[model samples]
Target: MLLFDQNGWDSRTYLGGWTTLGATADAVSPSTGERLGSFAVATAADVETAVDLAVSAQKTWAATSPEEKAAVLRKAAALLEGTTEVLATWLADEAGSAHGKAAFEAGLVASEFHLAAATAMMPYGQLLRTGRPRTSLARRVPVGVVGVISPFNFPAILAARSIAPALALGNAVVLKPDPRTTVAGGLYLAAILEEAGLPPGVLNVVPGGADVGAALVDEPRVPVISFTGSTPAGRAIGARAGELLKRAHLELGGNNALVVLEDADVEAAASAGAWGSFLHQGQICMTTGRHLVHESLYDRYVELLAEKASRLSAGPPASGAPLGPIIDAGQRDKVHSIVTRSVDAGARVLAGGSYDALFYSPTVLADVAPGQAAFEEEIFGPVASVTSFSTTEELVQLVNSSPYGLSLGILAGDAYAAFELADRMRSGIVHINDQTVDDEAQAPFGGVGASGTGVRFGGHEANIEAFTETQWVTIQGSIATYPF
Candidate 1:
């Protein structure tokens, strides 16, 4: 029973130079169902305090050189590497990430900072190639204060993904992490930023539920909002931001597809499908929700995939299980609802659909046809809906039928053919020989339609552009000799 040290790691809110302690509820460990610790639920007043601080600090931060911001990010990354074990342990307990996945997230969080560090020296603005005597230049300026709202799925990595780039681009942030991940996500996350010499009021953390999140969004001082969560919530935020005419950056839900062509190697494809659909219990937005294979390869692929899924079990992070429980009972039940509804609608469970508390089995539903909830919706659990398609046109139609356009995966022997088909995918990202669940820090990562809004986040130049407002400057060579 690894309980938290109540004296040190208890409920708290980080306000630049100060910390506040008082929680509305306790954060429970998903694996053991034990109380990990409590976290302070930020009230509307708390949110006001944070926004006021950010508004004051951002003016100073935006004036600093990019190199100076990069130094702080690098120092934060070094501090993260030193605190890996402790953070990983708490993340596993609070978020229920498996040991390997938890460790991977910790490393990836550190790497996210490095990627942002590389962008520090890159061009923040561009000069036009006007050959005229007068000079014309364009500069990218920060979008003032950024209000960040992150989900609990990959607490450290997801928060870092948005925070690193925003900070690198000279934006002060007021972050509101989900209550479930307050300690693992907000506390240490902000502590590192503060210790790395972030000036007072540059970064603030208010851990709470919907009210705190809503307050942050409603505040007028924070002109930009970066949120990662479900589409329903995102839509609401989008509407509010629109009413306020504020800039918004959203990375939302996904119901991705994995297409296996007739010529694909069934064994390899099955292995990839298993890992993509089951990693972190399919909590990732990029997780494959549908597996569509050509009729000739469907049966064999299903067999191999089921066999692989059967070997996995959800347990504590240190238990060497391949996965872990869902975030909590409500989320666990939501996943099971899809499984039950699919079964009631005539889908056959080929592998596993049983649940012991929050640990949902890696379920595979066979012959899941159209109109089924599992087939049409985002079954964001360790569940894979397997079905077959005949022609290439049918495959394309099936994949594009869904509203989501986040990512696509294609497996085929003919490399060019795979790329050709992938090009037509409605998704923002497509992989010829890999699973849909993939990301790199340097590549542009975002989606079209409901999957995301605004520009992508990565180490690319686009990220800098996303968080910045552009201004064009022109120098007049001589006072007008024209008419007057």
Candidate 2:
């Protein structure tokens, strides 16, 4: 039987000790809108129970050595690899990912787990000299239970980014995944962790929506919230976390740009831009939504970009086109509206711009002006907007004008020139000779301004530090006498 049979489902909430059936949420295929099955929807009360259990179990888990934790992560990585095919199928059905994209997401899950395992056993902590006579040492300690809320775009991999590291650092996690892709996000997640020998109550899965998420956030026991979703929702979480004085690590929206400089190879830039703009139907946060070209190469770059985008088709994964449908009608309609409005506002559509069913053709819009939606907003779809700039200053202004500062890409002839241009761009990650949609498990991945909450998902000191707190310990060689 298929792992994600549409006929029926056996979804349930994974509590600390056992799985329990609860309120039902019907899962539907994004590609066809067909009912996949009804799975349990966890409530606020259920969230409380899960958090309580996690808090109880965190004590024992925290005492476990980093090596032991790393071993568990390695085992989980192997188990995840074993379920690659099934995981890919579930993601394709629920998240509207093409076969290639689904496979990539599944593979990334295991690789990120391995990286996090290595990070767990690495040397951390330091002995500090504060110009004091006492010997001082800073040690890392777990930050209690962590609440992870993931979006549907990259359900398996994005959530694993936070979960693996948190567990590796001796902190338990309570996950609340998006309702749209619950199976790939939450249902089997706990099972895999348990199978990897994770102690019960160390990790729990509660599939829920907004209210459930709010409950998780409000629960004072859960000190840290790692969320990946829209910018508006991110702001809300940030505000609430601020009110409660809790830590929030958010990986939110992006309106990234790929700039084609005068010295760039038009064909190469166009190919990279097309892939960055249309991959996974532009559902990725770092998808290049805007294309800024130098006046010298604007026309040629636009022409090549249109040609490359036109060759791609949007359909099922088996169709062989690198593109696929949007997550659902709502997202599809939004993309269609952006294209239509851009066209009405004098932006010319050089390639396909229509949709049949849930599939939206890859579109390339040229002569996009300032007022156009495609030029102004995060059109999270298979659409790319092209505009021209005379100088690097103008290009920087155009890229930084967007309220979102997620990422930017520069296609320059010389590496030094590319890095120079990249340094001026106000994004978290700047790519030279590559597209903006790139992520690694060991990089400081996140955005600035509206893109994220100034917190990184992985890489360097921040990723490991996010899950643990530093304690300053000082000891004296001899006991001091106090005068009464």
Candidate 3:
């Protein structure tokens, strides 16, 4: 609800709504380190209020039939689809993303809703064919109140990914979004859900920072904690949830690796690598950070990638812009420092060693050695570091040695070669001849190790993980009459 001037001036707003200044930081524009509006920090009392409302509403919500839940979710999807243009514009401005990227993310949010709707109404467990002497059945039931803590990057889509499934299963959600981009996506979502006729308190939005989130997660009324953030943060939340005996679904950070074999198409591999590393300024958890190319083709692929990355222009978030600024100044400086240290450690900056505040040129580095910060950490920025490997064995060993295992992308010609490399990669999801960030609605999208603990996105994975619980209906007659 706030806009800044072109001369890097600031503004303020007192929009009359249920706003919570939970983030505690000013909502500064990435393009111009200028304050757009004051982000109020939500207090523990506010979190208690939100959780109480959700807990009060959950009983009725859980009693509603699955078909009713599906109807509401589907209608919400329709409303979201209708508001793509406005939603994308606001999202781009708030999050500093390209218009096209924002629109695509909005569209995906709508699609996830529809998919979750279908999951809500789908038939439950199947009956096994047993002897006529006994009868047995099973059912999938919904868990009660769920607490959703979403991150700033991909705010809309990621929030939708968790909320839709939780709602579809008839659980009231208390969502504590990252204060930085809460207005970017959550407001439109709440409006659409309201238009879809969801009852009050079923999807409560509590805008706040870490303290608010901590309160919600630790509350006894919140039975499930669904978190998407850094690994350290996730571990902290998980431990607290464990103390309370609450279920936790965590999606953490990653340092993904891209492996290119000698037989791979150099041009195609380079293109895929650049797209995976530069898209969203490499903020995506699945974005490729480490590049392992066979020595035979490493030089050629590096050259191609450098040329391609140098040509990418950084522009405003308006329509037709190829790309936009990073999410914030802190992230920009982190990336800059990592790149600078890598250069000092003998890595050569192949291209893009300059920056304009929030915009770091798409960067590529070569001659990267093991244990360097750029090679060791998850540089979630528009940067990729290339390393050489003498054989597929060496490549696999190097990638597996990292403490993190999220997603890995392997580039090779022969099907067997790709499969072989993928078989040895120590990651949850593996992509062959494709970019690592390419996600499908029906696939189990998540990570392993430092990346995350459970699956996300809209699919059987979400349905089974969100609502379905195993129940055994046993017959004593079966055990007594069974043949010995």
Candidate 4:
């Protein structure tokens, strides 16, 4: 098992001679208290070395033809598909995602890899009509080196989304996988990419903590920093990137709202909302943590939502469990703290509002005050807090009042009603009669305002953002066309 950093030639063939370095994070298995391998807490110097390597390697890699890049990415997709089980196992053990979900997340890595290959085939720049004394053509160039700072919640998929786009665009990448889940998932992936013929140092994965991230983002050679994590952290990173004059793409935290109108199918809405809100213990950025239900349906919806949450079974990720533990003790405490505050502030705990050991049962709270912690904060665990509103105007006001604008979901039988709800909700992505977390690889996924600064995915928009550039190509048909 190659640990920490890999040197390509020797590391790929060697299996068991890996050595651990730096202080290990308290990476407890969320399902059980099993102590997984610790993540190396990389220092500033480690980050500097990784960024330097990426910058050095990117110069040559960017010069390669797009066809060559496509071939390499295609190979990577195939390799990832072949190793799904191994990758899935790592994801389950480290991130506490259920086995089936872990497999799904790992599979997305391959899907995105394929998507990147497709994106590589896309033509860069465009020919414009010009009546010219001189002819000119423009082309986009790589931004050189990119620093990817990923989160622990969905390590494999989030890291792959950012890193794949960077590499596919011909920029070298320095990936800092979330320390919590680095060993079980990302390390395996770094090996696969290396074996799939990605140039040495073209893509490098460095496992580390917060200090390393600061170092990576601050480096002068790292021109772009892409981050997916909490709102506060995203702010800090955006500030640093601004200081360095580096391009920054942030997919930050969310307090997603799911509104169910009186006309909606109650049973369908209940099921979809439950799954959306509670999946991965509600740790996803797009998870619908808050529900603003129509007053007419609020009581019944809360009852059903609470019952569903109570019935959710939590266990080890390998057991084909429906739910697993929160990522770590810190997250577990954060969830608990939110619930405690809600209760103290007079919110009624409907069901399963307590935590034991690594597991916190799917929790549902009702009658929460608008300004309470549960109402205002991003309770990013398997906890659902519902509040009722009487009018469409009230629902819109409540949903838009939040600082977050990541995703908004609505459940309603009337298409027009759903459309109106979507128009009013303050979110970057909106779902109709569905879960907020449902995202297609081809569609752009991101948020606005504090939620994030930009969006990403593999498609025309992604290409424009990741690989395309704009240049005004001007030409003069005659010397008189040029004015002093």
For every model shown, the clashing-pair count is: 0, 0, 8, 1
TM-score of 4: 0.91
Model 3 lDDT tens row, 1-484: 2221212211211112244443445665676555655544567887777777788888998899888999999998987788788678767777887877788888888888998898887776667667765767776666777888988878988888888888887788887878788666455576677668788888777676788889988888888888988998999998998999988888898888898888899999999999999887788888889999999998899999999898887767763556688787788889999999999999999999778867789999999989888898888888989999996568878899877888888888985778875877888788888767866567787788888875755486565666445676756554464366
TM-score of each: 0.96, 0.96, 0.90, 0.91
Where is model 3 more than 4 Å wrong at Cα? Answer: 1-28, 33-41, 128-134, 473-484
- Worst 10-residue lDDT window, candidate 1: 1-10
325, model 3: CA deviation in Å? 1.5
Task: List the lowest-lDDT window of 10 residues for candidate 4.
Answer: 9-18
- Name the better of 2 and 3 by TM-score: 2
Whole-structure CA lDDT of model 1:
0.85
| CA error at residue 173 for candidate 1, angstroms | 0.4
Please estimate how well model 4 matches the true structure, expressed as its whole-model Cα lDDT. Answer: 0.79
Which lDDT values do the candidates have, in the order given?
0.85, 0.86, 0.79, 0.79
Model 2 C-alpha lDDT per residue in residues 1-484, reported as the tens digit of each score: 2333433346556687446565677788877777866677788999998998899999999898888999999998998898899888888888888998999998888887898789788776889986767888998888999999999889988888999889888899999989998888876566678778899999988888799999999999999999999999999999999999999998899989898888888888998999899999999999998899999999899899889888889886656667777887898898899999989999999998998888899999999978799998888899999999998788889988888888889998996888987787889888999998987787778899999966567763776788988898998888857796
Give the winner by lDDT: 2
Task: Give lDDT tens digits, candidate 4, residues 214-268.
Answer: 8888889888888899999999999988987888888899999988888988788
Counting only residues 3 or more apart in sequence or on different chains, how many pairs clash (N, Cα, C under 3 Å) in candidate 4? 1
Alpha-carbon lDDT of model 3:
0.79
**Which residue pairs collide in model 3, if any?**
21-40, 21-41, 21-42, 22-40, 22-41, 22-42, 22-208, 22-209
Quote the positional error of residue 258 for candidate 1 in Å.
Answer: 0.4
* Global fold similarity of model 1 (TM-score): 0.96
Candidate 1 residue lDDT tens string, 359-410? 8999888888888999888878999999899998999999998898898899
